[model samples]
Target: MKDFPSCFGESGVQVADFSSSTSRTAQNLVSCVYQCRLRGRSRLITVSWSKNLMGQGFSVGIDDNTNQCLCKVDIKPWLFSKKKGSKSLEADSSKIDIIWDLSSAKFGSGPEPLEGFYLGIVFERRMILLLGDMRKEAFKKTSATPVPSDPIFIAKREHIFGKKIFSTKVQFCDNGQLHDLVIECDTSAVSDPCLMIRVDSQTVMQVKRLRWKFRGNNTILVDGLAVEVFWDVHNWLFGTSLGNAVFMFKTNPSAEKLWVSQPLSDPHMLPWSWSQRFQDSQSQCLGFSLILYAWKNE
Candidate 1:
């Protein structure tokens, strides 16, 4: 299974459904992809977390450098009683084991566990990725040797809900300092709504006359690096009360090259599909993409 970003690239941008997704399916869902080097080869591992009426669940998917899925497994805490269990599969001619113990996991408003749990991915008895604080428990359960080299986080997609202020914490680079990201916009309050973005409570980028600039891209500096910000608030201004908005923060590999590479015909067009870019050669230049689907409750 592939983890697709709701926001697409500009060169071949095409609109995708954001307003039609049910609140349950589109809320509290987060997926993260990691780049791991195993046996001298690079591979991607996608871990997705979600919650439903049954309880919380997650899925782990392994893909090769070519973006081909080698194996995947879904763990449902309530249904399959998978709160504490492991699964084994074959990938790259090696035995791949995914072990997890979410029975003691702690969570906040979102689906992801805050702590008190461990999820490990073992390749040929070597631990490639381990999450959560229960490292000792994870190693004891998997009996896999922890490697010195850990995987690098590549991309993430999350669903956020808010009224005027949408807030989240993010790190622009691997092992980078965490920063507070806040997106504030109240279309109804002002005669002309302005979209303001802040990093660590300091306003960095602001779009005035949001009605005309509802869909566009801008570059901002963070941690001494350039980050391209793309947003689409079309549904927020024109669609129903349940309509949602999309925003993306893409960094690494020079955001300038990524934008200049695309045709400048449509200045206000938003991204279409991140999965499509992965298939194209453009994926090599694209570094990290943070896609956020902001749902308004009003």
Candidate 2:
């Protein structure tokens, strides 16, 4: 199996279909729908409430080969009452947890489900880093915390090497220049993790470190940063950021240039219209609709 990409690259998972009602004198009412997709299938697995008082929620996982239910798990909370002030409280109190075993499941058998193909994990000795927006104070506090000794699970087997993450992008950087590894820890439960890059004589070390401050509501963070040594021409292309915008530095480390696609104002214009000359050879020519609108007082 392939190694999983860090959470920094993982796409967001969203839960939908929640409805509730409550009275001023009572607890808040809540009901929600959770949906998950089965690997390699067009079917979407949905879990929701049942009208029966004893039946809190039900979950279903589909098998693509059979086009039938692979597993059906009932989630009945230990306690539930319609008269209760909050529907969510009742559901939570009566909910059941179920873990599925797919060893004998058909997801990975036969032709191998398109969504269930496990990509080979690619490991690199170089340290990984990330950078993004974060609260200034939180960043400072985390920086002062002591590093931890435990191994950090950057990605789960199902997430990185699993068959689910297909056609997704992965980026890696290894520059010789030292950089501050910044990360934003959003919850009090999770300690901010760090990557320590060090080199001695001929050996290179990438250490996993941790910080103390609880990230709180801050969602943006500078994951990590590094300056790479130029070894070969191919390495140069892969060493830089993979996004559309990147900062390039000169040999002196004093001069820098901002490389960006020229802004296109015409609503009908395609992204290729604004491509820089250097990117023309490597870029794909794709057209997309561009909408522009502004509100005006009548």
Task: Name the candidate that leads on lDDT.
Answer: 1
lDDT of 2 by residue, 108-219 (tens): 2111221311111000211111111222322242232211221111111111011111111112222233322221111123344332222222222222333321111111
Count the clashes in each prediction.
Answer: 3, 22
Which candidate achieves the best TM-score against the true structure? 1
lDDT of each: 0.73, 0.20
Candidate 2 TM-score, true structure as reference: 0.16
The residue-by-residue lDDT of candidate 1 on 49-110, one tens digit each, is 87765677887877766666677776653663658888898888989988888888899888
Query: What global local distance difference test value does model 1 have?
Result: 0.73
Residue 296 accuracy (lDDT) in model 1 = 79
RMSD in Å for all candidates: 5.5, 22.7
Clashing pairs in 1: 8-271, 8-272, 8-273
TM-score of 1: 0.83
